[model samples]
Target: MTREQFIKRIAPIAVQLRAEGSPIFPSVRIAQSILETGGTINPWNNLVGYKVGGGAITPYWQGKSVRKLTWEVYDGTRQDRVPADFRAYDSIEDGYRDQDLLFEKDRYRRVREAENPEEQADMLYMSGYATDPNYAVKLKMLMASYGLGRYDEEAVQLRKEWQERLQQLEQRKQALQARLQTLRQALAMTEIPEWAKEAVERAVQSRLIDTPLNGSYDFYRLLTILKRRGVI
Candidate 1:
């Protein structure tokens, strides 16, 4: 996805996270997340430096990571292998979600122990969580450059606006959907063969059941809940 799409998708989650006392993540920190996750420029679409596998198990993932410990460049380069338990995701949004979950994990107690982004970045860098010596500095720089220092204030104002806009959008979308559904039901009520009605109903249900493509849900639940919900 494009950078704008990525930002729009993760912004709410980031704001909610900070609002819930998850450390005020600056816009820069979030952008840095994009960078680490293979931003729009890269194809990896990894939001966090989640490596495959190395004996560490993400509380959210029932299966082991793809690699034990893989090499990732910490100095703004994807080259050079570094020993880290990198997390992986199928989509950019899932990566961000995983990062949030990872931070909440007890293993990252030091990061949770930090009170601010600077300290958190430092702790994450120094504690072997990130290998780059300048990781903290870069994160701070990103924060400043993007004017993310005012994350909390911005989040509040934007959240209010977002709520208003979301309400309006939802209302509009619901109206449109209702009209479409009504039209479908009317059409179904009209002269139509049973086979054709079944086909249309199946098609609509199929669309409704489009499964959430992201990872994180346990495999069994992922199957059961999504399927039960009529999602793929």
Candidate 2:
């Protein structure tokens, strides 16, 4: 498959993983998967090239296994063809979830906390996640070339918008609190006017203001309170 096709197939999964609070950057994971799977139609649905060790498949792994000829770098220079056992999942989603499981390994724990895609890729290489010395470099190149970093950028944008919204809400809350304090101080006056006292009584009767009946009420608060109580 072409790079675009590969991205279209896996990008949603990458985004989903990120939304689910996966510690790994979505772009880094997508880049690594693209590199491992060769951007082809992965019928086996093994997105991350996960290997099955000599031990029996874990009880939780109900999927089949495929032995494929994989290339591994030996002596830090030479590539050797070796047949390795890889998991065969029923679907691409399963493969992606399995990839998340792989990252949970002790060696990959640090990579999960990496600050960015580059850092995560570097940590993966340093932790011997892959034998290729240029693995991190290749992943970085793919990320830059295909605009894979857009996913990270999108997440950052979402956080920024959320923060702005929260700030607005906090400002509104503060303003309301200040207004309520002013109303309380006014209501504590020794000689409240008859009209003001009547409004305060109405607000108290409607349960809009939890303050005592003798409490003061501002014009805005009085209108809102009456409107909320369906009294106006």
Q: Name the top TM-score candidate.
A: 2
Per-residue lDDT tens digits for candidate 1, residues 1-232, read 8755666666666776565545436464475676565445234445566655443555544343443344545456665544554455555555555566766667677776876677777777766656567777887776666566566576667767777998999999999999999766654443434334443344346684343332122433434555556554
- What's each prediction's TM-score? 0.49, 0.64
Q: Which ten-residue region of model 1 has the weakest summed lDDT? A: 211-220
What's every prediction's RMSD, in angstroms? 19.7, 8.1
What Cα-based lDDT does every candidate model obtain?
Answer: 0.58, 0.76
Sequence-dependent TM-score of model 2: 0.64
lDDT of 1: 0.58
Q: Per-residue lDDT for 118-164 in model 2, tens only?
A: 99999988988888899999999989989999887666666567779
